[model samples]
Target: MHRTYSMRQSRAPTASQIENPPPPPSSTKGGRLFGRSNFGHAFRKGTAGAFGPDLAKKLSQLVKMEKNVMRSMELVGRERMEVAQQLSLWGEGCDEDVSDVTDKLGVLIYEIGELEDQFVDRYDQYRVTIKSIRNIEASVQPSRDRKQKITDQIAQLKYKEPNSPRIVVLEQELVRAEAESLVAEAQLSNITREKLKAAFTYQFDALREHCEKTAIIAGYGKHLLELVDDTPVTPGESRPAYDGYEASKAIIQDCEDALTNWVSGHAQVSSKLSTRARTLSQRRKNNASKRGEGVDLAGQDQPMKGDRDSWVAATEHGEIYQHGQDEDEEEEEEEAEGEHEETNGESGGGLSLMQRIGLQSKE
Candidate 1:
């Protein structure tokens, strides 16, 4: 059996943004990774563990590999934004419905890319936490080496000068080194378990958020697709003019509202864990409880890792206005637009609301 969407990310700020306004540091979210390439990443990985102490070498490699993962993710996010802009550009010359829908689709896809990039920052938190584990491993290595060195000297003194006066002193040093090594090893064991759990817990929680929001966009994307009329017409017959402008705009507003209101407790999807999996998870929790242990990193009350408003709709006034028209008013507006389309026998005039407002989908 597989784990369901049981993981929840609950870190977004609950405070209203239009009132508080995001701080200036958020400008760094769209910062690009300059001069990065596969070759450079490979070189970094190759050298990571090569010169490190033997005990920490493998963990050093792991740390570098995680950096590689973040780099790849950043690249994907950047490329997706480019693709979204290209999609919008291509659709600009099409008919009104296709043009409007594709433009909105571009907005959604670009938001996806922005979400991905934002996710990279959250993922870094996990990577940095793992680095703590690597540091502990590296620190433990010195004690291990000191203990081994003392042991080797003891063996050499025994062989070279049996019953030498220095042998007893060396033996005493070995005892002290062994005790130090024991403390270091114990610290390493406890830290490794604690940090490993915290790191992956952070990763999976962020992942849940990323995946759920993308799914939300996908659902709205399907709605946008429905607005496009795909009816087949006779070669000589003229098709009716498109009138989905109001509908498409309303859908965008709805999407923005949905995303803004989303929280972990209200996640749309959930999985049904297998009996075995549930049992195993329960056992793990029970064992941790028996240890009388505590965790510091995973549950700390922290500000959001990324901006929640980054992916939502924006306006030209340096403010986001939420439209709250009733269904009757929406239906009336649609009917009026339909009449206008039929009377004109073409699309409406001038730039639409989208162009006027200028959605700042990216930074």
Candidate 2:
């Protein structure tokens, strides 16, 4: 049999509740007709952050607000189920098509209410996790206060009695307090990160399942709407007798089956990011890949000046060698021309004009 969960009334315990019992959402409500007024919420809102240690006040307020939200959701779920029952009652005297459809819709809407109740339970899981953080914050506050108080005592003693032996004792106490505070701070950091992640993970998962199931119910409801004959008929002639009982039942059964079989892996809807988001994601991936490569490649990728220096040094060495060769060739040609001029006896001196010019330039 399909499970038809309600806002668990004050009746005999079900087998499921007996095994791993949790408080029903009904336990959180005011039991009165209209529930509590906003006055209680306003009073709580004004006072939540007014007490407690300064470090914990904000988180304490957040915890208080979450409680308010849970109570509100509980009220909403309870009222929704009532509305569903009223819908079925209103349709009891209508046509057969309207009657069956409204009854089936009531079932689905009641399921939504039940799901909301379940959501409140799961939401409490997140809220409880947050309260742990607030508790830790409150616990750590004492260590901070002790440390500050000891430091102040040491400062006052230094001014009144510089050589007081009690200053040494107080300083030692201050050191111990600081060490304890350090440990507390570290624990606070680690637990805060861990619980924050876990809390949100539970919340988003429940939300996804709830939304998907609601949409499935709506789709089936639309299918049920098709059974109604909207086409206009003659005033004197009545329309054919309605005979969509089996079809509507089949649709409702199909909806029940779909809801029963649904899972995260079988989810049909998907979310798409914007083009800019995709681009940024790709860029981050590229950066991560580049970082993963070895250090040698990373060094080559960097804009190092060593490469330019190495090339410049090689070019300078080549230029110096070529310049020396050219100088040697000029000296050899000058010697040969001097000999030729001497052998030809074409000048008064044995030196050629080129040699004389070279010597004059050197001088």
Indicate which candidate wins on TM-score: 1
Candidate 2 weakest ten by summed lDDT: 345-354
Query: lDDT per model, in order?
Result: 0.62, 0.62
Models 1 onward score TM values of 0.72, 0.68
Pull out the clashing pairs in model 1. 4-271
> Could you tell me which residue pairs clash in candidate 2?
none
- Which stretches in model 2 have alpha-carbon errors above 4 Å? 1-35, 271-363
lDDT of 1 by residue, 107-128 (tens): 7887687668767877877776
True lDDT of residue 349, candidate 1: 21
Q: Which ten residues in a row have the lowest lDDT in candidate 1?
A: 316-325
